[model samples]
Target: MAYTSEENYNPEDYLKDTLNKLDIGFVKVSNDDIILNHNLTFNKIFGYNHEKDLFGTKNLDYWLNSEERNKFREVLFKNGIVKKYITPAKKLDGEMIFLQITFKLNKNSKGEIISSEGIFIDVSERIKTEQKLKESEEKYRVFMETAKLEDLKASLYEKDLLARIFMDNISGFVVLLRPSTREIIAMNNYAKDMGGIPGLTCYSTIGQSENPCPWCLSPKLWKTGEAQHLVVDALDVTWDTYWNPISDNLYLHYGFDVTDQAKREKNLKELNQIKSQLLRRASHELKTPLVSIKGFTDLLLKLKTEEFQSKSLPIVQEIKDGCSRLELLVNDIILASKLESSQIILSKSLENVSELIFSAVKVLKGFSHARKQKILFDLHEEMFTMLDKDRIQEVLTNIISNAIKYTPKNGTIKLKSKTSKGYFVIMIEDNGIGFTSEEEKNIFTQFGKIERYGQGFDVVSEGSGLGLYIAKKILTKHKGAFG
Candidate 1:
């Protein structure tokens, strides 16, 4: 059982040499707590350079206190062995590290404990890593809890701000009421201005009643969970009221004041009635005088009195012309009013389209002669359809007269008639003083005028401005398309 090493050897020495060659540290401590033998790794683990450097100088008890050493001995004696026994120990340099050791009891042949042997493994790095991981998890948990509380607080603040903004900026009166007692719980400024108050019944405040009004809708809303609506008249104003249930026993009451709109509509109706009466009376008062003036002028022109004819012919003609213009103006105003009121009923019948255009041309030819303008007619595919002959003639006369009035002395007015797509189309075009695009848009609108001087007249002349308006309405009644 002995091995020769320079003539002084034993099995224990050979075992110690073999243990030192391996990575693990080995220790043998005798009874009485004296260090017997240890490997070089054991010395290095405790910050010593060599195995001989840690002999009996410091026993295992030196690294641990008496209490922990006794606990280690008790466990070893009870279990007969200790595996992975982790304990805190001090190094030779006075620094602390965690260690794991497995212990086995070394006994003699008589069963008397002699010494203790164990394996030592450094676990300081592993312990430090685990401590750091635990600390990091604690920090993260605290941060998440704090962030959650802050977010909840911010959300509540945002909701409160939005509710206040809505209540203050709303246009009409608004109130929140408790359905059972009809108590006003919340209200906006407009509601307060209308005598609403918290803890007051709506029937008492708004309806001036000792009890709940019969028209109060909160009871119905509580039963059906649906909104109710009504109209109320108070303080000379009309209110459109609505009741909406927001919660189990809470209802929203809102109303709009419509007094001003109603008054405006009533005033417009009265004004229209007065306008119709005035036009009717003016038509009668003006037409009679115009007819007599034209009649006397015609009678004087036909007289055989040579003295009167030579001296007063031009004067009579001037008076007759003035009467004719006045008559035209009155007629246009009356016709435009009738068209607007839908009073002009058409008696549509078959008519000669060509004859209508020719008659209009013949009447306007004298005006064209005075202006030295030529009227050219291009009747293409003349056909008859259902039309009011008088109205059609009036439309034609207005269009041709407008052309003569606008055209220069030598400008030619071209009147064309054609049938296209089952409708008769008439186009009256003149080259002199044509309207701009902007003017053309409102040309057929009543009293819509573009400021411009005449092409050949000494001064600018804008006629009644209703000529095209009346013509357009006539075409509209006949369901005829025009531009």
Candidate 2:
């Protein structure tokens, strides 16, 4: 076991030991194609029990194709070496496998060919993997090229293959049917779980009916040759379904269960109705008390008593202002509720558009005067339109008052009227603290108040935030638009 250099220093034995330990097969072949020597790995790679079983065997006999072996030798001799040349070869039992051989010719000092030494690696698995990948690519190419409905119908094998590929990957119930015969052709797992089976009538399997369901869209689909969509309730489930015409006879039906969604929608509707009713009731309750308080405050202000005028007049006036603001808030809430429920009917009449604009300006003149703002009107004379005078005046009041309130002291508000394309257009422009882009989106939304910080201007910014909302709704009812 322990040998010094002088005792066992054989170079041939050292080389064979080194070659046998390598994982790759090592082979030396003579110029006449006979294998001169091979290692243990070579024996294993060629399914031989020992190197003796392969010694002196013709290397060309191992190649599955003799022509390939001839070509490999021709290339090796011409180039004096060949690296990583892949060729099919057979094992001892005649099983074919691919090999990657790297070999080079060994030459004597006179430059004459002597022998060739090479390593062999089994590359059969790699080749098989590449072949499978190529086959998969071809299958995908065919799937994409024949994806049309007409093409799918032309070949039954392609139709079934594509349908299985398409249906298995989606998360919903899907079924293919013959609409004319009412026969089910295929169904996905989801449909199968619901008792769907091919070759059965769709009405019997999916609809679970002895006869065609009255809501079946096949008749309509056949007539129009168009896809139809419906939300149907069946088997205690709600489905949002689409029946698409694949051909004159075939139909592809697909949908998802919407039972929970339908229930949530019903609940939301009920909650909205309750909210509207509560708002209307609370607003009416607040309006009654506000009207009584305003009536009493006015009666107290009218008294000419010296004690009341000197001591209580300012306080009573404050109470009246508070009452007025409360009344406006309550009225806005009531109007918003009505608008949401679509309960408002306009009483329209023929009226002068200029006169209506003037009436709104006159109502807000005192407030603008107190802030030292000017209202300029450029009205067209004899401009008449069939509109609800009271409702239009309300809209004008909301816009003009907002201008007066938001504009700084000593600012100008211009009202211009024109007749264009059968519309009596009124434009209200003011130099006010304009809304930012973000704030403008919420301007006509209920309770979407644009909060303002004091900027050293006499501006009344407090509001119920429903004036624009109600105005927009009224304009919409009048078949007009607001921006």
Steric overlap count per candidate: 0, 0
lDDT of 2 by residue, 283-392 (tens): 88788988999998888777753558466778888999999988989999998999888898889888997988898889988999999998997989778878898888
Cα deviation of 53 in candidate 1 (Å)? 99
lDDT of each: 0.70, 0.77
Look at candidate 2 and tell me the lDDT of residue 330: 91
Cand. 1 Cα-lDDT: 0.70
Candidate 1 similarity to native, TM-score: 0.46
Q: List the candidates' TM-scores in order.
A: 0.46, 0.56
Give me the overall lDDT of model 2. 0.77
Give the least accurate 10-residue stretch of model 1, judged by summed lDDT.
Answer: 147-156
Q: What RMSD does each model have against the real structure?
A: 48.0, 31.9
Residue 280 displacement (Å), model 1:
2.9
Please give the distance, in angstroms, between residue 434's alpha carbon in candidate 2 and its true position after superposition. Answer: 1.6
Q: What is the lDDT of residue 131 in candidate 1?
A: 63
